[model samples]
Target: MRTRILLAVAAAATLTIAGCGKTPITPADSSAAIAGLGSEHVKVGMAYDIGGRGDKSFNDMAAAGLDRAKEELEIEATEATPEGGDDEGRLGALNKLIDSGHNPVIAVGFQYVNALTKVASEHPETTFAIIDDDSIKADNVVSLVFAEEQGSYLVGAAAALKSRSGVVGYIGGVEIPLLQKFEAGFAAGAKRVNPDVKVRTQYLSAPPDFSGFGDPDKAKKIATGMLADGADVIYAAAGGSGAGALQAVAAEKGATFIGVDSDQYQSADAQLQPVILTSMLKRVDNAVFQEIQAFIKGDRAGGTRRFDLKTDGVGYSTSNQALIKPLTPKLEQLRQQLYDGRIVAPTKP
Candidate 1:
């Protein structure tokens, strides 16, 4: 089923690029025009990370943006997950998109750097946008990264304030610089609020193992341990793994969990719903949608594009209206301070 979808997407992308500059095509026209070129109407393609679709984190958020482009911008877009493995699958998907003639092929995670760097160089005419990691530099690629530290800092402060015990916990999917930025910022924020606060940090896996991000068993075990050690609030930066952490929090009363990447409060299970105190919002959907819009408008660029707290790219969610109401005033003040240069959150690990 997935392979068939990828082939269809590749064919559509080929047709779109082959038909460019001919006529403004609508959905009805797409079939005929693409058929003439022996292609389809797949104009935009997004290659998802290892976490893939339905993780309720990074990839899901990017998919939302692609969906927006399809609706608002009248572009035909589809998402592809790497088939073989993380590295091989990412490269294969990227190559397929470019070979099919997609203009701005979107890569959804930082894990695509090596694949994108090679693919972007080979196909200079193709534009690429990567999220999270930005080690790659190419004239045809745009790097979209967020200030997780700033938002994590705010959530950390909130956790500190709400904790009956001075102990808080941070559970990461994998120990990478990106995750480290969350750890550092959360620690800094907690310290700023309460110097004596004890912040316990752990990762589902060490390194060379990206599989941990989606591992629920490991996350649950880690969270359970932290809860037993007196952690009242646990901030989970572990993609799908965080779901397990939320599960642990729900099982134990008087414990709270902080979400990441999106407004998880809205999507979490009803049993664990109230346990989610706040979520660190990384506006990947907004960024992806904007980038796709730019491509449609012919404004795609290269180099790194930073989305921070100042730009409203990163922050905490107020999805639960009643809960967020009280924090609004303080959040607004902190937002202004971040914008006015009064506060500088760490960008890199």
Candidate 2:
């Protein structure tokens, strides 16, 4: 089943807010969905992370994948976002979606790890997919994990190559293992090129307090400090807070910013686009589409499936020509080294 999961990323021609083209539907509104479409149609459910559908970063990428499934598979889809901060809220949402009879439910973010593990155990007959987590040891649970460090490594190199001050910065949403992966890759990639380059780092928050992912003000403050200290390039892996980081870089006379999860350059506001040097692309939408498509084909087998530099599951974006054009040759050389195992991005900082 894992072998069947390897497919190209879905090309999203449109990046509007989730449920943009259709009347909005949610898992709790199963009755409304049933009335509009018969039960004979397949129903899929997705539970979004902190900022939900319109985050324009992590969660939005997941929403795009679900949207594509709705269009191509004709599946009745319902989306839900948690309102509380604890695992209880996540557990309730998962239970509610499963009780609503939506099969192959997909949970976004590692925050859902414990909740999904408990729920998947109770509902052995149901299949579940989780992104960014691979600890669940159940046959009904499919762990769709990504090598985020691989992409971060590429953008880290880009930052070093373009840095005029010999210093770059990394602003993370949280000081967790996941965000650390980004910090590690970025620093490693930068030093790999310039050796003397300095990579400054800061986290907006720590574990059990995920608000950092959504707080742009704090991120901006941190980015501004880094820039003032001589960082001419900064990479943000701070989810919704990344907007604040980008804003800080834009205000700086010559600072450049790198984005994460999706093509932040493409998704960012028009006024903020030029400051974006490049983005580390993580194809969560592609993973979601493959999971749903597999379910529709009656393939319910579940296990850990990984997407990384070798599989094109993760890479750097090329949207900002002014910053990326001259550096392409060097970046590509490092990319090939990563793909061929000649170079490995450190997973820890």
Candidate 3:
């Protein structure tokens, strides 16, 4: 009882300070509601990857959805964070959340694949959602997967078209298959537009070393070196670390960058916005909100829910509106061509 009160209070405090996400609510009303939620609280537990909430990228987008659920679906939510990428620690955290009575829990990244599936099997009545990976199967598990490559392809095309040096670059946070899709699509899109264009792909770190997602300095160093190599435009698929790449672009004139996972042009530091040409929008918030609505409507089918370009789950951003206006038609044509199956994005570099 004491713990619940403390947690509820903390959450209320956070709500008061937070910008009210995609679904905002009045603090006084929400606080009273949170305190009284109890067994009736449409509770959702979220387990965050690596850098957790402050990434201002992937995790922040997920937080937006969860925040929306709090106000719109009247869900009481709690989040768990890992020290790094420790699978065991992640499992422990997830199980504890389940034991504490939060149902319809979500694991924010593929690192939780094995642990999430195992736990979901033990609690069949409770709905479970795993982001980024969909191979897991169980009556209670729901896969929240996205077509990231489709969005990457658009940004890749933009980078190629905007590059005066004819060489653009791509940087992946981790060398995992998920980030691989970003690298592959970026390279392919660039090649599609300018067959002679050079797309340089670099992975900051390998699996089990997810620090790549959080390390801005390392990304900055790599972006610097890549820029020195004559790459005028760079696309970064690294999480928070991608911000570092933007910093590098900021330092150089006429150099632009591509962002990932969120509308980072809007999310980034003001000075960095000019350098961020556009971002690949992976709508994690929309996915989270949709699932919560499904649960509210009693529609858990225990299957994969794909948020692809076809469903507006992903796309390119125009936060730098004036900069991209001239290229919108071309980009739109490519997007439609890809969506209509006229163009296919390759997933391997």
lDDT of 1 by residue, 152-206 (tens): 8778777887788999999988898889999988887777678999999998887
Tens-digit lDDT track for model 3 on 1-349? 0100111112332321110011223365654434532445577898888778978899999998898778755778999887646878888879878999988898898889888878977888898888898888777788888778888888888898899999999999999888988888888888888999998888889967778887889999999999999999999888889888999999989999988888887877787888888888887887787776666656655788877676557888876886777777788888888888999998777
lDDT of each: 0.74, 0.82, 0.79
lDDT against true structure, model 1: 0.74
Q: Select the stronger candidate by lDDT from 1 and 3.
A: 3
Steric clash pairs (candidate 3): none
lDDT of 1 at 286: 64
TM-scores, all candidates, are 0.85, 0.88, 0.87
Clash count of each predicted structure:
1, 0, 0
Q: Give the TM-score of candidate 2.
A: 0.88
Per-residue lDDT of candidate 2, residues 1-349 (tens digit): 3433554432222222110011112334333322323234678889987668998889988998898778755788888888776788888788888999999899999999989989998999999999999888788998898888888888899999999999999999989998999999999999989999999999999977888888999999999999999999999999999999999999998989998888887788899999999888887877787778667656787788787765456788888887788888898888888888999999999
Highest-scoring model, TM-score? 2
Rank ordering of all candidates by lDDT, starting from the highest: 2, 3, 1
Worst 10 residues of 1 by lDDT: 1-10
User: 337, model 3: CA deviation in Å?
Assistant: 0.8
